[model samples]
Target: MRFTLSSSILLAILLAILAWPVAGCGPTPSAPQAAAIPLESFSGRVLTTGLEAPWELSFGPDDMLWVTEREGRRITRIDPATGEMTEAITIDEVLVDQQHQGLLGMAFDPLLLQGDDRNYVYVAYTYDATPDDGDEQDDPRAKVVRLTYSESAETLGEPVELISGVPAGSDHNGGRLKIGPDELLYYSLGEQGANQFNRYCAPIEAQRLPTLAEVEAEDWSAYKGKILRMELDGSIPADNPELGGVQSHIFSYGHRNPQGLVFGPDGALYAVEHGPNTDDEVNLIEAGGNYGWPHIAGYRDDQAYVYANWSAAPDCEQLTWTGLTDPAGIPKSVPVQTESAWEQDFVEPLKTLFTVHNSYDFEDETCGASYFICRPSVAPSSVDVYPHDGPIPGWGGSLLATTLKNGAVYRFKLSGDARGIRDVDKLFDTVNRYRDLAIGPDDRTFYIATDTSGLTRDTEGGATDQLANPGSILVFTFTGGRVKSASR
Candidate 1:
């Protein structure tokens, strides 16, 4: 259906005439403004530095923030109110800073310090036997273990393997873990070097691409790129979706390297995925559903691939809006054509992106994978979707996240009562760059983690060479819709 020059121009004019009246329309009466927010900044002292590739943050039962550092193989504690940091314990048995390996994720048992219910910290780390010498991939051992905390000594005691035998590879070792509203430990698992079709192994003979739920059931014997839900004791839940009369632990599947997981105020699970070069996605997850991956990049209206049976398919038409430009410098979607022009103008590169996959395989082959990796932004990673004064007011329950590449925290707010999801605004940004954010108990205070390796620094630290010191964490307090200040 190629478009003729005159026909294209006429069609564009007709569309423009129809859309001009609604150009500035918004769902809300008080539309987002163009002015910069004078954000307040607060800086907290470095709780604990000298660690390597620190990732993941959560508050402990004591109300202090608990942090995990990958390379240093240690779990540290921070007194958010006092700015004092303490190293609780280090896992000397686990390896750190290896390609796709390290002490990756941690979650505290909500009920800690009970008699028989003594709470424990669940940790996912690289368990390779490889020495500190280079070439960590050859070791290949990654597992999830629970570390019990002893109040007397202020340390993480003996480790117990909650789940084991998870295969590892140079890439695709998904390590993000979170305990959901249901009190089940939910974590993502990468395919560990399996073919792309492994992502589609769902629906049995139904032939439809597996939904997140179905993919999780893709036979743990062959599990990859799937999310699993299990009891704190590591037992499969009785209610888990069953296949062929066999109970499975998978919640959803068909995800390519999901590094971020968070639950919304309404109990919906949200995940950020690395897409194939062009598409990154933040998915609202449901039970027994599959998030279309290898088979479908972004939302495909063409519906070339069979989406998971119960997975609500993405609206592809809305995703076609890429902010590219025509030869004449008029901004348009990719492959700008005169026949079909964007009714709405492209604003800024979406300040908030949920999925950011790269083209590089980051493994055996050096070839480009073609997945678009989201770059870093100087702006704050947080965005807001709620309205301060509107029909549905008050903390509209926005979700905040960060990027490892460019260190931008992205906050997203949801409007409308519809069960489905919608994109809101790319609200305010922070002065410093960081990834992964935790909303303080106060709700208004936000904390960010910065990787020292990549930032513009006084010295040019080469990429491949591991730096003894990598990054620091920052704290910010946002009051009245702006950041107050940032702390070290």
Candidate 2:
């Protein structure tokens, strides 16, 4: 919500830079584009390590790096200068981790920048339905709360719940939050955690079916499979697309676990979504628009996507997504319809990936198969518009997208008024599940949270993912050069 300058002014500066455009960046269909920042321009160092499962990061008051740890169930304040954990507020009681669900997104109230008396940090997390439940998902639900920040005490005070009962599961809890320039809160909800289950299961059981009735039974609006917009105080806006004032918080629906949401420089909303095995997408968000999932993935309703490990072929169309509820609570879609989700009008992603396997391509090989892509997908964990006056060429106006399965950070540049892709460059890659990210107030320095839990679990738990390393927060400051074929 607190941009250093007005978007209009930022756009003006961006236009001036765009005047001196670089070479060969014009669109081509088959090949990946060249890096906007020369290979030598990029360098990274660990800001800190030992984060259990760091999920989100934000530059809070006094320039402290505020981070949310999913497995630790705490919001921690890190002194970036010394890479030390200075303080933390534990919320493990309401922040259970389900590998995917846990303490998630965070945003600082913008008013704090203007004055000191009422700075509150909003945190979103998943809570257990009952104590010591055998099930890991355990009927766990999601919630967003505002914690008072006390600069004097260097602590986060008691929390006040703003939104509650958002749909949740061990996977696909969609716990990403962003406050818009309008000062309203925007949160995402995935499709009932069903996709994560059906991704592997064959001959799905009827019991796994989730109906519109069951979805509506939750306290919040048609949250699952939707993006919700609410006032900072949790009230519905008059401009919201709700009819008759019921189910008022929905900003848009029809998404399959949107992991990243950020407003572009032109004030347009963007979302990064995961696909079924292939075609992971970066979409341009529209209010009240649908992003097809379970029914359709990428641009079309493709049916057959196979899991290379088990070679299990599952059809997206044959899979079941029960009913879709309109904002007014009426069923817009017929119950239990198994058709191409594309049949019902839906928007397409701005960019798509074949898979996460080739995220770090050292060179354009003679044979593409030599450089493998991750099997199921390369899940994008977070995305942000880089608003910076920085040294990296053409990065002053770019999208910084971070990954989970592939463990890479990508910088994307758009072309023309349509915001279509001009290029996609892999900025860096590492042996970590890069979970979430945030840029500094200066915008020149960027920060990322990695999954120590995901990376090291296999090694420590006696499994065999040899890429294990301690989870860490990485700081990258860009400088320009053309050095080639190097990686850490």
Candidate 3:
């Protein structure tokens, strides 16, 4: 049946047809709008590849890039311009155990290459501990050694043990070394990953301090989860604060796993540490200060974190780990302490990467079994400060932090005094675990080192094992002028 329509009715129908939404023509319903990328213009290139689990990257006084291979147990030097590689040294004494345990953290002496006869390179690594007379086997131990670099042979030798027998385990070694403005060596040690996961029955001693007799006997059992300040000869600094009336190598205490340590231009020490499930922290480290761990996460607001002392549980070995709080199968014998319940005074973090409420949803169907990678924490690995005269505009006096889970560098703009973080912006996001980064001599180029393999969030925000650049150093050069955001 056909019917003739009036002119006015026909015009109205045409207008309605034009106003109807079309598929893929506009924003999708219930989908979030993606924000614009921040960088003006940049280009990336592979500076050097084929590294075996590169852990640290630093530019030496010779203008050559020095890297530590965690699993390879070797130190390599690379020419940044030509990408030529050279093996400086290979320590056969180093032990490599799955992912987190191996050679880690390298620092150069300030007098290196100055012909001052002090061309030293400090390295921290795990080693096999000698079993006692009756014990089956001893836990793994870590040591810090000083090696002299030969100018003529271009090799490292003459190993001098600075400190040894520190608490080390299969996980949470921390292992970050830095030379402070006072010309002292600063090393960060983790809590050995106790009271969680496989080691849930082990006690956490981050708050423990050594006795005066222990220091005299060289007992570093209380050194776990601490920042150590020492002389080049391995003696404790004279001016170090005496905590609990006992002086030792400990500079600060109560750290979980502080993997990133750097001295800012203002002479203040900064540390970046990983939290349990949330509240990754950027801290302004102070001598003798305690950054609460296991008791407080991020702030004392009692948000999403609670310190569950599984080691104190009566039947800890019998309970299954659900990796959640207040789950059904967990017994009430386990002591769970909130942030407010702790009465100790501790320093709060300068910045928390991402903090959420206790009710925040943690499950993500897209992440599948590796759902923890989809959590808010980015697993901060390393940090560096950009100078005020950096080549990139609006990036001066900023803190550049590297992440493992998110595979990105988070640029945090610092306040004038450098004590506060004004704001943060994510940059150089790729599907690779960013282990460390170093600024080039020109300040226009940035060299980022990535792990050989790891789980990282893909572009679609799902957990994936694919990496764009593995075991390689990527160079990101800033190009002036406005253009579309470029990231690999």
Best by TM-score: 3
Candidate 3: segments with Cα more than 4 A from true spot: 1-40, 131-137, 324-329, 482-488
Residue-level lDDT for 379 in candidate 2:
77
Error of 3 at 464 (Å): 1.3
Ranked by lDDT, the better of candidates 2 and 3 is 3
Which prediction has the highest lDDT against the true structure?
3
Q: Native-vs-model 2 lDDT?
A: 0.63
Please, what is the TM-score per model?
0.65, 0.75, 0.89
lDDT of 3 at 68: 95
Where does candidate 2 have its weakest 10-residue lDDT segment?
455-464
Pairs of residues clashing in candidate 2: 41-479, 357-373, 357-374, 358-373
Per-residue CA lDDT of model 2 for 1-488, tens digit only, reads 11233444344323322222221111225334543444335456677888877888878767888888888888888987788897568875665655777888888788774575667888888886665767646567788899887776777878898877766776676778998888889988776555234443322111122344543564553466778888888776778874223446777766767889998767788888766555677888887676666555565533233212111233444444421211123223322323242366777777776422223232224213322232334678889887645555566667878877555676777665636766666654555567778787766677888887543212111212344334688876655465343221
Q: How do all the candidates rank in terms of lDDT, highest first? A: 3, 2, 1
lDDT of 3 at 290: 91
Candidate 3: residue 293 lDDT (0-100): 87
lDDT (10s digit) by residue, model 3, range 185-244 = 999999999888888898888899999999999989999899999998889988999999
Candidates' lDDT values, in order? Answer: 0.51, 0.63, 0.82
